[model samples]
Target chain A: MKWCTKDIILFNKEKEFVDTVVVPLVPISWDKNMTATVREGEHITILAREIEHQLMGRMVEAPPFTYLKSESMEERMKRLKLWEKNIKESGIGYIFYLTSDVDWNQKNHNMLDMIWLPAVPLEHMEGKARDAYLDETVQDILKVITESWQQFSE
Target chain B: MSNKEHDVTRRQFLNYTLTGVGGFMAAGMLMPMVRFAVDPLLQNKKTGKMVSVVSVDELTDQPQRKTFKVKKVDGWHEFEEQKIAYVFKKKNGDIMALSPICTHLGCTVNWNDPAYPNEYHCPCHGGRYTKTGINIPGTPPPAPLHVYDMKVKDGTVYLGDAHPRGGA
Candidate 1:
């Protein structure tokens, strides 16, 4: 659900049903790969919004966990783990770390599902092509989500 | 100049006419500007303009999802948003359109999911609704899915916003 007053109120009332949270990982960098970083951020952010719309009844999108690209991996992990802890304590069964970063995908996340899909340059694509690309990507991610749900239930 | 020359000075007459003409010109320029400034405020709120979505003859006993564009106004900005409505006909031959948004936590419900046959199923939390969109007892959904305000024209179906069939 969205981070709005109306949705938040509803979330509280129906917290039991909303058992999942998708945290979008956005990397911010104004240095060498600044343009690429911005593009990746846009890609991941748009995907997060679409995913929220698709599965909004079941999950809440945690506010994006944006970290600087220059920061040490150890420090970033430490910070993110804290968010995971808080969310778990509050009764979220499924925690997904959605990103377009290959580095994050390579890392070992025990409980949190690290979903990494290559960033598509949607801004450069036409409307039909963009939708076709986005729909395919969203469907792929949704397959991962539902499969995981089945595995967890089993 | 001969008959009414005593009425007023030449300077006074010119001053009155000049000021009157200048005032008219000023008002003419200001009028459009004033209207433009308040044009959005003066715009009528088109709350319920029914847009025809699909033809009436195509609807069957089974519900079919139709997509339409809704003009959404947010303060000064206005844009068209894509929306879906599920239309079907009852045994009595009357048409009904239901919004897919689940009443429980605002999730989209699907018609006849593989897991739940012949019923609307919420994939999120297992909420179930009957063919008529009534929430089953003990389900997560507390109320029935909303019905779209609908009208049937010559051969087309026009739909407005969905209104809740309120219940605890």
Candidate 2:
């Protein structure tokens, strides 16, 4: 019965796998002091290991509207490497999840979902869609997504 | 006068002894106050002075980072170059200035971050603001970035430490 339990889905949209990444989910190093939560929304932590796997093309889409904070490209990559190393050494699955009111599937929403990628370098995120995963200067886009999702749920 | 010749006057001895003791006590009491008053006047350092950070020609309609220095006096020494950060732009073709100092903690903010793209970033604390200097509440920063009050005379931009962000 325990083995029959469903694997927690990471993404809403399932794309054909580039490869079957069955590597055991490892826990990540998260600062207990650092946390964020929206009113009646999800609390999530994006780890460095997941970032590495995502960048390596092993994983598909990152969680919709993940927020990250970083300064430069080299530093971001270095953080990813460190996150990956932490996961490997700890043998504790690094990736974790939090469900939020914001739905990526919704047509148009007007609520901002903060996806904090604290370790990712800022310079690398420039002009990239992944930049949304970082602290957005203008959170209007994410706001729309969250609002839409909230309406859908109701 | 035969055994012990004593011509010393009592008045002279009393006067000499009292003057010596009085001078020592007076100096002891006055030392702390003298040092206290003189130290501040002597050691007072300039926090920062108003300086021209950008010129009209240098500032475009788009926000651009401009670096300048102000002489900060410390004690007897002078800080020849204290780096000050600002965002320069010409809104409606009129030159304007924005201070990069975050309203929350006074940390210098950078205008361009490849990570956040169009947001200004504070490294000391995770303070962030839009290009237009609006505060994003709930983050580490409590308020928006400050805009330096300025005037354009002929062509150059002059700045003062008048915090005008969100009426700060």
Best by lDDT: 1
Candidate 2 lDDT over B32-62, as tens digits, reads 9899989978865544245766667776656
Docking level for model 2 = incorrect
Candidate 1 clash figure, as a count: 0
TM-score of model 1 (first chain only): 0.95
Per model, the share of native interface contacts recovered reads 0.58, 0.00
Candidate 1 chain A minimal-lDDT segment of 10 residues: A127-136
lDDT of candidate 1 at residue A124, scale 0 to 100: 93
If scored against the real structure, what TM-score would every candidate get? 0.75, 0.37
Instruction: Tell me which residue pairs clash in candidate 1.
Output: none
All candidates: TM-score of chain A: 0.95, 0.20
Candidate 1 chain B worst ten-residue window by lDDT: B1-10
Sliding window of 10 residues with minimal summed lDDT for model 2 chain A: A17-26
- In candidate 1, stretches whose alpha carbon ends up further than 4 angstroms from where it belongs are A125-140, A150-154, B1-43, B55-59, B92-94, B152-156, B166-168
